[model samples]
Target: MPLLPPWFHVRLTFGDGAVVDARAVVSEGRITIGDLSAGPPAPPDGHTAPADFAGPARHRARPSWPRGREGRRLVAEAYRAAQSEGRDPVLAVMRETGRSRRRSLRLVAAARDAGLLPPRHNRH
Candidate 1:
C-alpha cells in the first residue's frame, strides 16, 4: 500500500482507467471514497483580510460546496440509517462511506436540523 501524507490528496485509477479521489480510509486494498485524510494547513494570518474589505488577492481559492439536492438527500439518509443502528452516526458514516468526521458531522447536523429523523420520543 502506498503511504500518503495526511495533507496529501489521492486520486485512484480503476481497472478501466477511470480515476476517483479516495476518501478517508482504505480497506482491503480497495480505495474507498470519503476517507478521513488530513486537510491542508491553515493559511498564515497575513494571508487573510477583514471580511469587509473587497479586493483582488494573490491567492484566490475557495472550498467546494456540496452538490445538488440529491447529494444532500444521500447524506441525510446515511445519517439516519447510522443513528437507527445504535452507532455514532458520524463514526458509522466514516466507516461506511469513508467521509471525515467533519464531513459526517455536517451531514448529521443537516439531517437533524431538517427533522429527517423521527422524534426521539418515537424510538423505544
Candidate 2:
C-alpha cells in the first residue's frame, strides 16, 4: 500500500543534536498525530554525542572538568597538589577549574568515589 501524504509536517532539531519529525494526518476533517518517542532521538550522523553535554540546548554549558575517569584523576591530582602546597583543597580546585566551592566539593567527592583519593575521615 502506498503511504499517503500527511496533512501537516514539521521537523524539530534539539540542541543536543536530536532530530524529530512530526506529521499530522487529517481524515474526515479530524486530525490525527502519531506518538512521540519515549526518549530523545539519536544524532543523525550515527556518531555518539558528547557525554558531557547536559541541560537544554539554549541553556547548555560545558563542564569545567574533563569527562569520565580522566576528570576524576585530574580532580584527585588537584587535591594532592593543594595538600602538598599547604593551600586549601577546595580553594585550589576552585582556582584550577574556576568552579564554585559547592561544585568543587562535588568533584572532590566524585574523585574519591573513583578511588583516586583516600576516603574522607570525617562524615558530614
User: Which residue runs of candidate 2 sit more than 4 Å off their true CA positions?
Assistant: 1-64, 122-124
Using Cα atoms with residue i matched to residue i, what is each candidate's TM-score against the true structure?
0.35, 0.46
Q: Write down the worst ten-residue block by lDDT for model 1.
A: 35-44
Candidate 1: tens digits of C-alpha lDDT, residues 1-124: 9876343367665544345554454566665456533323333564643563444677635434355555566666766787688877668656644567887777666656667654445565
Residues 1-124, model 2: lDDT tens digits: 9787566776778776566776777877787876443335576688775675555577435455687898778888989999999999988887777788998899999999888988999667
> Best candidate per TM-score, number?
2
Query: TM-score for model 1?
Result: 0.35
Give the Å shift of residue 66 in candidate 1. Answer: 7.2
Clashes of each: 8, 0
lDDT of 2 at 37: 37
Error of 1 at 106 (Å): 1.4
